[model samples]
Target: MIPAGFEYHRPADLASAVGLLQEHGEEARVVAGGHSLIPMMKLRMAELGHLVDLQAIGELKGIEIADGTAILGAMTTQHELIEHADLATAIPLLREAALQIADPQVRYLGTVGGNVANGDPGNDMPGLMQCLGARFELYGPAGTRQVAARDFYESAYFTARADDEILTKVTIPVPAAGTGYAYAKQKRKIGDYATAAAAVLVGTASASVAMTNLSDTPVWSEEAGMALANGDIEGCVAAMLAAIDPQEDMRGPIAFKKHVAAVILRRAIDSALSRRA
Candidate 1:
């Protein structure tokens, strides 16, 4: 299906992009990689009069490691993250999560910003970012504001971002030297959206556990993380599953999803902690 007719505007800078969005207000949308939005537009699930393309903005495509954080530009592709040597070592969990998103073709064109900022409950990156305590840099007609990744997603297809703002970058605090992490996703097939997925990160004495596709927003189980830190593996898994109210949708039955979440949580915890031993 063809996308609804729309005027395209490519801005070479963030300020111009923001201004265009502000001018168009509800009638315009930003396009980064277009892997996610274009498909939705084709289905008419999204319709807009104008598109503010950020591709021409050269600054929004690099990765920087400094001050104990890995900052990724909004236009950075999944392939870039997967192949970056520094990022791969600094946060193997992020690389693992990136590898699990769709297949080669999709990963080549899908930007990390679009994957998470789209606010789709099924995308694998948001929950992973939450588990890692990442931060989002948002820019708009007002100014710039930083938001914790966990607070970014309000619900499926909705976020804290105003219609006029663009997610400029994601900054992940570099994990401690020996920190352990894992991302375990259970999808029905190679390119399928996960049925249930878990991303876990454990520091010396602290931990975090988050789940994707199990709720309206990426679900971070603080209680479960605490349980894991206390060495109560069973309790941690139970707490994580408890936080979820699985829906019986076309994806799977509620009971089955709950079971998958439990199983994946267990594996994710084990994988994350195994690095310590």
Candidate 2:
């Protein structure tokens, strides 16, 4: 299905994009890779009078590492991220998660910024970002503001983005020495959304566990992670199940999703801890 008619604007610079968004407000939608937005537009779930394309903005298209953080530009493609050597070495969790995002064709066109900024609970990156303690950089007429990954998503398919703001970059902290990370998801097929998933990053003493498709928003279970860190797998599993409230849907029943989430959490923990051992 073709999307509804919309005025297209390619902004060459950040200022132009922000100005356009400020003027158009809710009537406008930002298009990066368009992998997520275009489908919704075609379904009429998203209607925009104007599309402010960010592809022409050159600064928003590269991978750079500095100050012990991987700064991924909002427009960086998933394929680009998968092949980045620095990211591969410094933050393999992101690289590992990126490879599982979608098929190769979609990965070539899907932007990391679009994935997380869309705030879809089914998307893989949000949970991984939460585990990695990533920071989102929001740019607008008010200048730039940094939002922690934990605070970025307000609900499923909803974000902290204001009418006049754009997400410009994702800043991931360098993991501490001996830290380990893993991401696991149960999908029906390649390129399919996760039925249930877990992303875990563990240090010698603590762990961060984030799950997707189990609630209104991606949920990071601090209590469960603490239990896992204490070497109480049963307690950790119980806590995880208690924290998730997956709804019954065509994807799977709530009980099954909760069960799958627990299984994935166990695998994620094993994968993460094994690397450190």
Candidate 3:
């Protein structure tokens, strides 16, 4: 289906993109990879007067690691994350999770910013970002501010980012030495969204656990992480289950999804613990 006609603007920089968004207001939508928005537009679910494309903004594309932190530009593709030698060394869990997102072809086109900014519970990055305790950088007419990944999502398709703000980068503190991480996802087939998934990061000083496709937004269970750290797997699982509000879907019934979430999360936790240095 063809999308409704809309004016397209490719801004050369972040300020211009934010200005376009401000000019168009709620009538404009910023598109990165177009993986999520284009389909909605085609379905007439999203009608916009202006489509501000950020692809031309050179500042919104790259990866940088410094001062024990990694800054990933919003346009960084999954394939780029997988191919980045230093990034993989610094955070192998990112590569592990990126590999599980869609397929090779989609990975080449799907932007990490698109994956996390939209508050789509099924997208892999949000949960992983929560587990990593990442921060999102937003640029707008008001200048810049940061939002913690844990506080970014308010609901499905809703995030802390204002319509006039563009998410420009994601900043994550590098996992400390001896940190271990794993992303476990269960799906019916390749390219399918996870029926249930978990991302876990266990370090010498702290741990984080987050779940995907378990609620309207990604579920970050700090309680569960602490339980796991205290050596109570069952308690951790119970905490995780208590944190999510899974709904019935084509993937399976609510009970089945809960079961899958439990099994996958347990496996991810165990795997991460084993890999801990």
Candidate 4:
């Protein structure tokens, strides 16, 4: 299926892109990587009169690590995340999660910002970012502001990002040394969305547990993490199950999803615990 006709603007700078979005207002949609939006457009689920392409904005493309934090440009591709030596060293969980997102081809083109900012529960990054306690940087006509990953998603295809705002960066505080992390996903096959997935990080100071494809938004289970810290895997899994109400879909029935969620959560927790330094 072909997307609807639309005026396209490829802006070389963030200001120009934001200006285009500001001028076009609700009729405009900013596109990065096009992995998510293009499909929606082709299906006519999304129709935009003005498409603001962020690809040409060089400022929105790079990885920087400083002062125990890693800041990734919104346009950084999944492949880039998976391949970066510094990022792989700083946050192995991110690379592990990126490797599970679709196939190599899709990873090559799918930007991290597109995956998380769209509020797609099935996308791997959102849940992982939540587990890592990442923050999103949004730029708009008003100015720049930050939102925590845990607070970003409002619903499917809805987020804290305002209509005229563009997600420009993701700021992740590096997991403490000796932290244990795991991302466990149950999917039908390569390139398929997770039936149920879990991302767990256990550090000396804190722990976070997040689930994917289990609800309208990524489910962050603080209680589950606390339970795991108390050395009760079953209690942690139970807490996680109680936190989400997964919808029935091609993945499975409600009961099946719950069971899968339980299994994956258990596996992720156990794996992370074993790796804890």
Candidate 2 lDDT (Cα, 0 to 1): 0.88
lDDT of each: 0.90, 0.88, 0.93, 0.92
Give the residue spans of candidate 4 off by over 4 A.
none
Q: What TM-score does each of the candidates earn?
A: 0.98, 0.97, 0.98, 0.98
Name every residue pair that clashes in candidate 3.
Answer: none
The candidates, ranked best first by lDDT, are 3, 4, 1, 2
lDDT of 2 by residue, 50-95 (tens): 9999999998888888888899999999999999898898888888
Pick by TM-score: 1 or 3, better one: 3
List model 1 lDDT by residue over 13-124, tens digit each: 9999988988988999998788778989999999999988988998788999998999999899999999999999988998999999999998898898988888989889
Top model by lDDT, which number? 3
Q: 1-277 in candidate 3: lDDT tens per residue?
A: 8899999998898888888887878899999899999999999999999999988898999999999999999999999999999999999999999999999989999999999999898999999999999999998899999999999999998999998888989999999988889999999999999999999988776789999999999999989999887778899899999999999989989999999999999999989999999
Please give, for residues 106-192, the per-residue lDDT of candidate 4 as tens digits: 988899889988888889999999999999999999999999999999998799999889999999999889999999999999899
Q: After superposition, how far is residue 200 of candidate 1 from its true place, in Å?
A: 0.6
Model 2 is weakest, by summed lDDT over 10 consecutive residues, at 268-277
lDDT of 2 at 258: 82
